[model samples]
Target: MAWLLVLQGCAGWQSALDPKGPAAGELAWLIWFFTGLCAVVWVLVMVALVAPLMMRSPARSEPLALDAGAEHRKVRLVVTAVGVTALILVGLTLLSFFANRTLAAIGSDAALTIRVTGHQWWWEVRYEAAQPSRILTTANEIHIPAGEPVRLVLTSTDVIHSFWVPSIAGKLDLIPGYVNVLDIKADKPGVYRGQCAEFCGAQHANMGTFIIAEPRPQFDGWLNDQLRAAAAPTSADAKAGADLFLKRACVMCHRIGGTVAGGTVAPDLTHIASRQTLAAGTLTMSRGNLAAWIADPQGIKPGSHMPVVDLDGDELNAIVAYLEGLK
Candidate 1:
């Protein structure tokens, strides 16, 4: 009971009861209504059980004959109760159907569409644009304008994964070779946390992302910035780091715009430093974290695709410096 009270008080970015969008809000209401109704039914059952126990008496010495009138009354009472129960169940079923329809009605006129591809441990996000040149690609983080509908087309390249942001939308599966569309919106500007609701692999629990809802102008500004190429390194150390990155095994699995590293097997590092977190929310984005990840990725996330780079201290520092300047 105490835990239930604590759960009821949850209003964080990951809580369904603290919904910030139309779909989640409707779902929250439905959940509460169903929960309340179930509680009422449970209480009635408990009372019925306890009432007979509290009124229990010793058995009579002689067997008594059945009263026909009382038996008919009991039969009528049982029939009425069964009918009421059936009516309640049918009403709840219709209510659920209507709620599902309401959820389906949202985002029919979405102005933007994003393609999210699920990997074993990370998310590949692509914001589609009318012009090919205007398309923006990033990973682990999504940005959208508040008060506008956006559709997400989800698919998995390897195994099954589920995209879930409890505060804004419900869980939807991303099956291999199948595209599933989920629409979401935010009523206000805020950051909402999400994770892979399916168990895909060893690092499935670590596969997380964030949705940043901002004003229209701010969202547009962010989109414009993301569409640009990676920033050129200005310092000598950064330039050296960039050289080391290209010379090492990094270029085989990662891509940096305007560079020769054109690997598509990993997350794009074009503007990696601009993101809030790294390694699909495993660590905060920083030079030290980047150096550690490069040096020993298996130590950070076991069974991850990122291999440990056998580089000297100086080489590792230089590489981290270069990647950190990508913003």
Candidate 2:
């Protein structure tokens, strides 16, 4: 009995009850309201349980001997009225609360805008309006400043997608031509996991991303760094690798700074070294992982849009060096 009460008190329901990000405190209040409702419901249920045990007359065994029709009708009418009233009150209260809270949250004005465009199985994040025509595109990685309200303007290129970071806020749909805005924030600096909530395609299960909330100064610095275009490799091996990258099959579906290979199908390798992970946030951006992914992309992610590139040992090493020097 005590354990049941404890479980009720500590409801582990995701999103609705247990919140983790900026909206967490606001959602905490909402959970309290629901908890109060549970208390009332529990009390009513107890009364309903006890009433039968206490009021079950001894004459009930011999229904034909007693005047049970009128009493039964009266009891039924009272129970129906009470049940209807209780349900109506609960519904009204919940509706009013939902409207009030949702309106207040949506009406908030001072929020920074982030345009998040969904790709086949990855997210193309950009900081809009900060700079004109200078779009800083990153794949499957969203970095923002902590302690500031940020609104994501979501849209998809192909199928319907959903941007959901359980620890941050609720899921918002990404539809083609229609931009849905989701207001979110973080109080502390950490990396939170996110996933595409809607079923997209074969690689939908692998559609995951990370949200990194940094302090104001750090975030600003990162933003500035991303704004700058990719730089050329300095080392001999890296320079050789850059030439090989341009001459090879990678030029068809990828882009780099000041390069003719301006294909938009794949992620931009402008600053690939600065990124924590690669291949739409699937593999860690290490030398070994990069080598393997470049060798056989289908092996890493079966339905990936990127195809394998056949390069010689020296050429592969040089390409790796050039990519690693992108930071």
Candidate 3:
């Protein structure tokens, strides 16, 4: 029953055991194979230890002689066991080498490449395109086509971070001034959760993102939509909020498409409302949450790069109204 509970805990959307891609599937097989092999070895050792006790006689009086033949047999047995253990080790090593080769072969002909830059607590996602005009930039959400391999070029702008989506691929480090490429794919259309595996800073636990896999056509449509400029404010309150956003310090750290706010220190706010979460999964996307975050960012996520903005109730509401319409 205890073992059953442990196994059940391993099952989840973000678990490596619940593999959804070729790389993860291969790794899962290796894990099971190694575990089973170790179990068999453990049983054999237990039996060997108990067999001597079971064959002993408690009342024996005579001392057993260590004959030449008995000594030779014991030596042979030890040599054979050592040879078998060595062979098993070599076989497992070869298996791992072949599995790594197979993982490397995937995404060789990838149709998409995304440059993912790691910040202190968020992900800066940029879809590379041959035509500069076709490039798309977003934050915290990665969209890819199901059944097709995609390449991720990873780098860090600040401290080192690890990009890990356990269901799709293994963890890879994003070092400063160095680029590492990770290939991943999704076997089906689903949302897979990911997080920064490395301990970067105070908010490392909250540095989460989502991998959204869809059909090719659907992914293309979404990409096209993201490439367009931010929508214009239509309501009077939203317009006032937009003006306030530009007038205040909000324009110094975030970017809004087709607007003057082009700061690159933080996540882009071009489609902030469209995202499912805010502050790197700190809060769900909503008006109240947005207002709270803008009003007291330190209260929501302490040590975050975003500072608290001073605004009255009317200005705060207008700003929230404007940001909510950005999508």
Which model scores highest in lDDT?
3
> Which tens-of-lDDT digit does each residue in 1-327 have in candidate 2?
222222232224234345555566566565676678778768877887797788756546765775779679868968996987789688858866874576347427634678888888888887776458556776677888887778888999999999987667767899998989888877677766678999999888777777788998999899888878788789999999988888887888788867777867778788888877776667777898888888888988898888878888888888999999888
* Worst 10 contiguous positions by lDDT, candidate 2: 2-11
TM-score of 3: 0.93
Over 4 Å off, model 2: 1-18, 24-56, 60-62, 65-107
Model 1 TM:
0.93
Superposed on all Cα atoms, model 2 deviates from the true structure by an RMSD in Å of: 6.7
lDDT of each: 0.87, 0.76, 0.87
Query: Per-residue alpha-carbon lDDT of model 3 for 131-169, expressed as tens digits?
Result: 999988899989899999999999999999999988888
Model 2 quality (TM-score): 0.82
Clashing pairs in 3: none
When sorted by lDDT, best at the front, the candidate numbers are 3, 1, 2
- Each prediction's RMSD to truth: 4.2, 6.7, 4.3
